[model samples]
Target: MGIQEIAQATGLSKATVSRALRGLPTVAGSTVDQVRRVADELGYVPSSAAAGLATGRQRAVGVVLPVIDRWFTAKALGGVDAELRAAGYDLVLYNLGGPGGDRHRAFRRAMLRQRVDALVLLSLVLDETERRELQVSELPTVVIGGPAHDLRNVGVDDHEVAALAVAHLTGLGHREVAYVGGEDEAGFTVAVPYLRRDGFTEAMARAGAPVRADRYADGRFSFAGGVAAGAVLLEVPAPDRPTAVVCASDEMALGVVVAAHRLGLEVPRDVSVTGVDGHEYGEVLGLTTVAQDPEAQGRVAARTVVLEAQGASPGPLPPSAARLVVRRTTAGPCR
Candidate 1:
C-alpha cells in the first residue's frame, strides 16, 4: 500500500506519514509508532529511490574491486556490506578485472557514471588516469589496501603482516625459513608483496636467522601458485632445505600443505608453515597467521565514503594494523 493509504488507515496526514516513515525528528514519536504499526499491517514498503531523490542522496555507495573471486577481496567486501547495510545504506559492487585495456575502459565508461553517491575502492591498483577519473566524480572516496594517494584509505600495513608471519616461524626455532608471494607487482606498487618480503627479511635479521636467497619464491596469489612455490621449496637438499615456510596468503598456505603431503613431508612435524590473512580455512589447516579484520575495514571504508557524500568530513582515515595469531602451524626446530 502507498503512504497515503497507510496515512488514511492511521488517520494521519500524508506529510506526517512520510516524515514518520523516514523517522524524521519533526514527527511526534506516537504518530510515528502509529504509522509504523499500520504500515506493517498493510505490508507497506517505501521506495528508497524516491526518498533518496528528496534527500539529494541515493542512499547507495559504490565499491570497486580488482577481482571478486579472491578470498581476501571477498572477505573484505563482506565486511563492507554488513557495515553499510547497518547504517541504512546500499552497496553497488563494481568488478574491475581484466588486462589494462579492459580495466581502463570499465573505469572510464561505467564506474564514473555518477550513479553512486560515493565510492569505496577495495584493493584496486589504479593508475594515474584512473585516479584522476575517480577524483572527477567529486564524491567522497575511501580506498582499502591502496597505495598512498590524495584520497583517504584504510588497510593494514602489508609489510607488518609479512613480518609477523616470518617472525612467528623464527620464534618457533626455525632458522631457515622461506618466503613465498605473488608475482604481480602492479598491486605491490602499494607495497603489498614487496613490503611483506621486507618484513620477512627484517624479522629474520632481528632473530639472527639465516636468510637463504633460493628459499624465496615468487608465484601468483592462488592455490596453483602456492603449489608451484611449495614444489620448489621442497626440492632443496635435505640439510639446506627450509624447515619452515611463510606465505603471503592462506590460499597459498593450503597449497603448500597439499604439496607437502604429496611430497611425503608432514606439517609441523617435518616442516612448519605460516601465512598472512586469516582465511576461514586457516583454522581448519591449523595455520598460524596475521589476522586483519577485512570486514571491519570494509565497514569503515563504507562509513567514510557515506559521510563524505553527506558533506560531513570524516576526518582522516585511520591506519590499519595487523595482529599475530599463533596456531599449530609452526613448531620447534627439527633435530
Candidate 2:
C-alpha cells in the first residue's frame, strides 16, 4: 500500500524500491524486477504528478489539433494514441476548434502550466506569436505536416504528395483534370491549401497537362463540400468538362463520386477522380489516392516527443513520400 510496504514485500530497502519506481538506472535489474512485481501485486498505480515533481518529467505529451471530427485528424490521433499508450505515456488532447477563444486559452495560456513533458502539434497552422509561446515552453515539440520554429517535425512532403496525386491522374490519360479543395483558412496561420495548390500546379506542369484556373474549385474538406463541388463540375457541358478530377482530400473524392452517380455517370468511365489521405472509405469507393502513413507519422511524433522528454535532441523532420493506391475511381481517357 505504501513505499515501505512495497519494499518489505519485495525484501528490498525502501530507497531501492523508490529508485525502481522512479525508473532510475541506479537500482539493480533484479531489484527493480522484484520491486515492480510486488508493486503490481499490490495494485500500485504510481502518482505521475508526484513523480514528475522529483524527476522534472510529467510523463505525458500534449497533442494540439484543429479538429478531431475530420477524417485525417481522427486517423492521425488513432496512431498517436496507440503509440503513446504502448510507450507508457499519456496523451493530452486539445481540440483547437471553435473560435480563437478556446484555442488561446488552452494552447497559449493554460498549456504552460507544465502539465506535459512535451507537445505534439498535429497539422496546426501556428503564427509567430503562438510558435514563440511553444518554443518558450522549452519542452520538446514535434510538428506533423510542416516545420515549427526550433522544433522537430514528422510528416509527408505536402508538395510532393500533391505532385504524386497529379502524376497518377495524368498517367491514367487524364489530360483535362480538375482540382477540388478548400482554402487553408481553417485554423492557425499556416497556408497548407496554398502549398498543396502549388504542388498540384507543379505536378500538372511536369505532366504537360493544362492546369486551368477555372478547373480549380474551392470547397470545404468534407463530404458535403465535395458533393457541392462535384455538382458544379458535373454541370459543365460535356465538351467543356474535364475527363478527371483530383481532390485534395478523400472526403472530397467521395463527394465527386456521389455527384457522378447522381448525374448518371459511372466513375472512371464518364469521369475519373482521385483523392489524397487514403481514408478507410476510399477502398469501398475504389478511389485512387496517394497514401501517407498517418499511423507511422503518429508513432514517430510520439517517439520524438518522448526522446525530447529524456533530454535527447529532436531529429530532423521526416520526408513525405507518396505511394499510389489505384482503384476503380480513376482510369484511362473516357471512351
Candidate 3:
C-alpha cells in the first residue's frame, strides 16, 4: 500500500503519517504507534527509494579505507557498521587498494555525484585534486586520521601515542633505544609515520637517551620487516646495542620478539621492546605498548558524520585516548 492509503486508513494527514512512520521526533508517540499499526495491517512496505527521492537524502554512509586486509580495518569497519546500522542507515565501503591506485579515479566522479549522505575517510591524506573536489562538493565528511583542513576528525594523536611508548621504555631505566617504523621513509604517509618518529625523538631526548644515528631502521610495517630490522639492531656489538626498542605497530614488535628469540636473547633482558596499536592479542603476547583502538576511532568518526548528515551541527569529534598497556616485553636496561 502507499503512504496516502495508510494516512486515509489511520484518519491522519499524509505528512503526519510519513513523519510518524519515520519516527521523527515531531510526531507524537501515540500517533507513531497508530500509523505503524495501520501500516502493519495493510501490509504496506514503505519505499526507501521513494523516501530518498522526496527528502533528497540517500540514507547511506560511505566508508573509505586504504586497505581491508589488516586487523585494524576489520575492527574499525565493525565499529562503523554498528553505528550506521543503529541510525537506520546503510554502509557503502570503498577500499582504495594503495597509495597510487588507478581505482581511486572512480571515486572522484562518484563522490561528486552525491550518492551517499555522508563519508568517513580512514587513514588517508587527501591529495590536492581530491581535496578541491570534495571541498566544493559540500558533502558532510568526517576524517578518521589526523587533522584534515578543518574537517571533522577523530583519531589518536600519533605523536603522543609514540611518546607514551617511549616513556614506558625510558621509565624502566632503558637507554640507547632503537626504533622500527613503517615501510621505507618515502612510502610513509605524510603525517602518520613522521609524527610517530618525531615523538620517539622528542621523548628520547627528554629522558636523556637520544636515539643513536644507527639505531633507526625503515621497513614495511609487517612481521617480516620487523624481523629484518630487528636483526640489524641486534647484530651490532653488545656494548653498542640499544637496550630497548620501540616499534610503530604491534606486528612489527612481534617480529622483533621473534628475531630476538632466534638470536638466543631473552626478551627484556637482552633488549626490551614496546609498540603502538591496541591489537587484541597484545596482552596475550605480553608486549608492552601504547594501545589506541582504531575500532573506537571509527565509531567516533561515524557518529560525527551521521549527526552532521541528519542536519545536526555536531562539534568536533572526541579525541581517541592513548592508553599505555604494560606487558612483559619491556624492562630495565640491560648492561
- Provide TM-scores for the models: 0.78, 0.79, 0.80
Error of 1 at 178 (Å): 0.6
Best by lDDT: 3
Candidate 3 Cα RMSD (Å) = 10.8
Q: How would you encode candidate 1's per-residue C-alpha lDDT over 1-335 as one tens digit per residue? A: 68889978988889989888767899889987787767656756455533343353668787777667777788789988998898888887777663342564345433343446777877666778778766655667787875546777798877678777776776667888888886553242345677778888888888888587888887577778888899999876677778999988787888888888888888888788888888888888788888887888887888787776766866876667788888887788785
Off by over 4 Å in 3: 1-56, 102-106, 183-188
Off by over 4 Å in 1: 1-56, 104-106, 109-112, 184-190
lDDT of 3 at 172: 81
Could you give candidate 3's per-residue lDDT for residues 123-191 as a string of tens digits?
666777778767755667887766666666778888898889888877888888999986532122456
lDDT (Cα atoms) of all candidates against the true structure: 0.75, 0.76, 0.77
The 10 consecutive residues of candidate 3 with the worst lDDT sum are: 182-191
Question: How would you encode candidate 2's per-residue C-alpha lDDT over 1-335 as one tens digit per residue?
Answer: 57888987877888888888766789888877777667756645445433453364567788888777766677778888998999898888888883363566445432444567777887776667677767556667787766555556687777877888887777777788888888544563254566677899888988888588889987577788899999999778787888898888888889999988998888888899888887989987788988887778888888877876776755666585568898888888764
Worst 10-residue lDDT window for candidate 1 reads: 105-114
